[model samples]
Target chain A: MSDPYVKVRDLVTHYGTRQILNGVSVDVERGEIMVIMGGSGSGKSTLLRHMLGLERPTSGSIEILGREITTMSELDLYELSKKIGVAFQGGALFSSMTVGDNVMLPLQEHTKLPIDTMRIMMRMKLEVVDLAGFEGLMPSELSGGMVKRAAFARAVAMDPPLLFCDEPSAGLDPVVSRALDELILRLRDAMDMSIVVVTHELDSAFYIADRITVLDKGDILAIGTVEEVKNDSSERIQSLLNRKLREEEPDPDAYLARLTGTKL
Target chain B: MAADHETAGPARLVESLGRGTVRAVESFGYAASIFGETVKWILLGRRRGQAVRSGPIVSEMMDVGIEAIPIVTLLTFTIGVMLSIQGLDLLRPFGAEQQVGIGVALGVTREFAPLITGILVAGRSGSALAARIGFMTISEEVAALRVMGINPVRFLVAPALLAMLIMLPSLTVWADLVALIGGGLYISADLGMTMSAYVDQVLTTLEVDDVMHGIAKSAIFAVVITVIGVVEGSTVEGGAEGVGRATTSSVVKAISAIVLTDMFFVFAATR
Candidate 1:
């Protein structure tokens, strides 16, 4: 309802003994595209999963459109889920369903519209992703980029007010990733929706980010506009921008314990 | 210390067995919860489209029933012939070979057809259900369905439970009929008994209760097999090989549960 269409507060998450996110927080304004950039295990994807309500945090809250998702009932959650779409890193389309069926699924499941209208709606969504005629293709038949676009089509099929894209540019070539980044921007501008993109591509992040959230090993190193982030005086942000690795060496005992699958 | 070491092997064996029993019971409860949720979705839950349709139910029937007919028929037919030969030989010792008709009829209708069909379906369609759902799980299609506001239990498990319920009893009936026919033909050929005599004796021997009892057991077996498959599948982890392991686990679990259920039904029904 407010300017911050998405607000994450003090999100802490863990898997087994590993803490993935430690008090991470972020906010994305309505109609703005925020890019969350982090190295692997920095919790960008974990944050995305929490926002999508795919998993619960250890202690924190994610509010989408002013509703806390973690506490929603099953039916309530289903209703909320229908209003927010997600494009997974791996496309995550149903392999058994056709691209057309995959996109039409949301309409079919949620609407009383007839088959003809649902088909047209599906085609329109597919067209939005530049995958108009590829509707008949199965996910298995699509190339990596096509699969990504098809997944994007399915995610936006319901025309949700909010969308989350995880690693949309991760495995794509530069040209396709650029194209995807442009498409994401276009979706935000034309569809009047807020978006949060989790990616590691520096160029794409800087190119498309209204604000970039840099996460380093479960903590936010910086959060501001691309220029503001670049101008920030933190050495960690400087090292991240310069692609510098940590200079510290691993402890021998910890290394040995890790090698032996020992828990600390 | 020496005595403790000597007894450690047996002690460890008992401890492991006890743990295994607890794990099995826990898994059964897990499967039962999934089964309960699936039934709720099938009957009263909020999910709609695809799963509640007749299309999935029929497809599952063809998978669990129609496709299984030939093998079930073959297996039951072999057992029928074997039972006839053995029954005739044993009765011949007492000049009672004519009683083979009642013996084979009662055996096929009351227990053999249902038990064997249960085992076969558990091995065949049950494992297939687990593999399909497990692959969907590992590949995140199950999660995808969830994120899209569809319950995976509704989308995947409910149709399977419904289909198994519809088809298992029907398949058991077919098994009973095929076994009866096989034994009848064997008796006509091996003992010079007329087909009419064999048919008459079978019809006289098998009451409505006998047939209904077997069908009831088949329904229960269907429930057990379906639950185990769905629960094993929805919990699959690791990856591609996990799907395979889930399939095997479902089969083993379904068969074990099927036997345990059958034993319970046997005791309860007979009393």
Candidate 2:
């Protein structure tokens, strides 16, 4: 009944002269896990960045919690950003800070909570991510999986209603990846949060996603429930699901032009 | 073909000239933007209910200013002794070796003390700040800060700028005192002149304006170094190599900017 937590309409983005996202639109409902699946250069990450207002789109509008962010000023965007959390692919934890401090950073910045309360909350969040009692360690000391978990804890430190994760399972072992997927499910159920995950891992997407939006070359090829996406008749979708490469008709003229740096 | 070459030569020259001018303007604008944001956060971010934590600022002060005292003292002392020797050597030919006291006082207070401190801080803290921030930028920590609704400029650059502003003038004062003592001791030891006589000469030659001028230059130099370091760090590209390049550029730009600012100040004062 309520409006979607995020509404991205006909978003177009370009980097220099090249287009990244072309008229791509996506919606994420409240208390839903919407997985955005795409291969590299499919512009899934670009869309996520735009949703976070980290970059401006060439055209189209993004409304987060009913606020259009396309033209929002920096100060107003800061206000809007308070309700959202982003877990970057590389676990972007502040290297200078301890795990506990990193987790508590949002609380420290955005709230007037007492120091003791903040520390307790930080521990609880870390505990949720199965990183309890590892608060004193620097991010550099953590394993890759642990770093991603710590980053997740930091993102949800404020218990934001909306969360965006860029490639949460990337570069992790299968077991670690599965555990992270379970953690995402638990967080969503516990917090009643809306999560938008941009990932290319098919298993993780199928397992954790309430719905999947498959992107191909800056266009949405399919968006539906897991079964619907799996049964979709599009050859590209089937190819993605089967991990088969797309066969392209050769363009010898273009190939030669590229090799020779000349126009045909 | 000759006519085409003639036209292309002039066109290429004009294009490069325009590009260079554009780059220079963009760099100036970027530096000014950083400075403006830093000042805004330092002066106004707190009043608007944003807490400006003093802990980081104090820690930065210790790192940039207090921790630097030993090296600053050592180098400035050497410069002072050198000034004494050189001044005496030049004045001895005119049978005016006593004038070495005036030369040492004026030179140390007006130039050497602040200049040396500026260069040292630029090389030490500037490089570190740039590399630290650049690495953070490359690692996406800067973007993380943005997503958390914390202004990176407010959180990182403001404290650094504040630390530099407060500590640089203080360090210059320290440099001035130590340099004067070093020159005074050298003169007393070399000429068998009483320290009190050398002190009198320095006192007569030095004025409030000279000391103030050096302190002013140090403050400006502090701004230049902090701005360059923070700007380079924030705008880093590529990855680790980009961070390294940014650190190098920060130091080189800071030192160059400091010297140019000093020259401008001297020109303004003389005029």
Candidate 3:
């Protein structure tokens, strides 16, 4: 009923001359978990990067928390970023820092709190991510799952109102992935935070997503509740759900141009 | 048609040369931008709620300066001894071996000390900086900082730049003293000159301007090395092998830049 927390309208992007996202759009409501699902090269990650203002779109607009971000200045972006948390796919924790310091970085940068207070808050965030006692170790000492958990703790260090997770459960065991999904659910329900997750894991998506948006080749195939997306009669959706490869209708001219290294 | 065909090969070669010039200019522009942002952050980041952390700067000083002291001492000492030996050999025919003090003092203070220290730091600290930042770029740590509204230049480059600015000149002064001592030992021991006499020759031959010249050049070399390393590291692509390539490029570029800057300083000082 109210305005969505994030509104991306007709976003188009390009990597050099090749189009990555072509007029793709989606919306995320407050206190909702929106899972963006696609196979590799579906432009999902590019979409996430654009929403975070890491990359500017070739055209269209992105509104986050009712503010336009595409043309915002550095100072304005800093203000906006304080309320937005991002968890990169590879953890991206500062390797030079201990896990505790990494978790406390956002607070240290943005808050004027004392060192002891920051450390206490850092421990609390770590506890939430199930990494309470591992703060003294460096990120290299952590396992794959623990690294991901530490990265999550850092992202939510300031209790941001909106969280953007590139892929929370990617490359983890089923148990860890399921636990991450539960964590996502708890963050949304308990903290009242809106979340946008870009993932291709079907089980994780269905388990945590309030709504799912399916992308295929830079276009959205469907956007609806989990049940609504499942009941859709689109062949591409069916193939994606069944884990089957859909045969694409080939363009002979384009295929020939690609092979000959000349445009016709 | 004949004329066009005759000129085509030369024209293509010229076109590529022009493109390369443009690319080089663009690369310098990018480096200038990084340098400018680093200065701005160091000066104004605190007013904007982002303070450049001092812990990293102190740590960098240790890595780039304190850790480098022993090697700088050893190499400059050897250079001084070689200069003394060569000076004495040339002056011996004239029965003026004692004049070796003038040669060693003038040579070490005016040129060799700063040049040797610059090259050493380029190879040691510059390469390490390039590799460290290269890996961080590939791992998306730099991007993560940006996503958190933290300026990467402020968080990463400011510390190294400040450390180099403070350390390189200090190392040059240290190198000057060590090399002079080394050459003085030879003058006193083999040439039958008293230690105080050798010291007096060095002091009389050297001017404040000569010592200041080397220190000033060392400071310039420090900026060039730090900027080159940061630029090379941040632009690295392709992953681990890319990091290795960037580190090599950083050292090569830094060494070349240092030599060119030293030459310019010499030209200016003579004028």
Q: For candidate 3, write residues B1-271 as lDDT tens digits.
A: 9999889989999999999999889889999999899999999988988888899899999999999999999999999888899998899999988688998998999899999999999999999999999999999899899889888899899999999999999999999999999998987888887889999989999999999999999999999999999989989999999999999999999999999989998998999
Q: What is the two-chain DockQ of model 2?
A: 0.85
Cα deviation at A256, candidate 2, in Å, is 6.2
Writing each residue's lDDT as its tens digit, candidate 1 over B209-245 gives: 9999999999999998998888888889899889889
Computed on C-alphas against the true complex, the DockQ of each candidate is 0.57, 0.85, 0.79
**Deviation of model 1 at B125, angstroms:** 1.4
True lDDT of residue A28, candidate 2? 95
Interface RMSD of 3: 0.8
Candidate 2 lDDT by residue in tens digits, A145-174:
999999999999989999999999999999
- TM-score leaderboard ranking: 2, 3, 1
- Candidate 1 segments whose C-alpha is farther than 4 A from its true place: A1-3, A249-264, B1-22, B46-51
User: Best by TM-score, which number?
Assistant: 2
**lDDT (tens digit, per residue) of candidate 3 on A1-264:** 888989999999999999999898899999999999999999999999899888999998999999999999988987899899888889999999999999999998999999999999999999998999999999999998888889989999989989999889999999988988888888788789999999999999999999999998999999999999989999989999999988889999999999999978
Better of 1 and 3 by lDDT: 3
lDDT of all predictions: 0.89, 0.94, 0.93
Better of 2 and 3 by DockQ: 2
Ranking by lDDT: 2, 3, 1
RMSD (Cα, Å) of candidate 1?
2.9
